[model samples]
Target: MAIMLSGHVIGLLKEYMQDLVEQARQETSAQERFGFAATVYRPDHAISDLLALLDDRIESEGMQVGLPEGFLHEIWSLCNQASVHVADRVYVESNVGSEAGSKARTRELTYRALLAFIEARGRASAQGEQGVMES
Candidate 1:
């Protein structure tokens, strides 16, 4: 059962990562042709708040007391990687100022990545709960 759970979690994480990469590529391509300004999206909420929500959901389901520390670390690491990728994309493709553009791109990518990760995790947890209920 633990192995199955682990496999499910890893699959979800991989899908989340692939989605982030696709998003980054699309954003980079858009910025390359036409200079685009960063706009605040609904999913650009605080990471802490998202994590708190996840914690609540996890507790309510009685599946686990807390998210695994390794999962948390991997999420953070992915966010950082996404941020760096955005920064590099903006710097290399955009004609904007170096420091400012890079900073803005980094911020945008970080928030987007966080939002994507949280949404994916939420969906996965919900599915898991549904499975438990059905069983």
Candidate 2:
């Protein structure tokens, strides 16, 4: 069964994702201005960053934020499950588009893919429950 997350958890995830995206944007801007790129950044890097942020948040203010118990483990599992798919989508999006891609774009695409995966998972889980109820 797909794991269910509260709206608050998703909200926090989105906020963290945006933070990473903005960081990528700043890094990309610096690289452009300085003519030197930092270490290669990829979707997996972004995922790991999100996981790290989640870990810190859980450790710091999980109860205050109403994050359920095991939220970190659940999100880690979800990220592991979605990682390949998110990476693939980000790759296709960054490469297939006519627009030039930057670190920020890559992060945005990765986050979008991950969010889409989670939403789809939630929908599938809800549908499965409904089917069981009807059976």
Candidate 3:
């Protein structure tokens, strides 16, 4: 059975994914600015620590950070339900008789859906910010 994801769920997923992408972008930008050092005093240090700090700042206000285990569990459970629902509604079984092919198709569909969601959310966020600036 194929799962059908609603417009709202897709939208939410896209928004969430976009936020993650933007966060990664910002982290990269920050790293470019602050990652290098004049001296190799601490070459053993990981860039991940710096990235984590940047991520923390990015999500400091009006955003969630380091969600508790219980909250994460709940969110995962909900996401699983949503995925199942969507898969059942939209996924079509391949007649090629190849399990790998079916799995690949499903993965492709999932990735495309995620990308669409991210693009939509990024555009909406940009528009909202632009509106705020114009006001």
Best-first order by lDDT:
2, 1, 3
lDDT of 1 at 135: 100
Q: By how many angstroms RMSD does model 1 differ from the true structure?
A: 12.6
Local accuracy of candidate 3 as per-residue lDDT tens digits, 1-135: 122334554454445544544554465466659874332211112122223433454456213433332433333343344454434433443333355332224433443443444445456667887999999
Question: What's every prediction's RMSD, in angstroms?
Answer: 12.6, 1.6, 16.3
Off by over 4 Å in 2: none
Best by TM-score: 2
Clash tally, candidates in order: 0, 0, 12
Of 2 and 3, the candidate ahead on lDDT is 2
Over the stretch 1-135, how does candidate 2's per-residue lDDT look in tens digits?
A: 445887888998898899988988888788879998556678888788888988998899989988888888898899899999999999898888886667778779999999999999998898999999999
Q: Which run of 10 residues does model 1 get worst, by summed lDDT?
A: 41-50
Q: For residues 6-116, write the lDDT of model 1, one tens digit per residue.
A: 555555444444454466557767876797865543223333333444445445642454345455555545445444444444445444544444333443444455545
Relative to the true structure, candidate 3 reaches a TM of 0.31
Model 3 / residue 56 / CA error / Å: 20
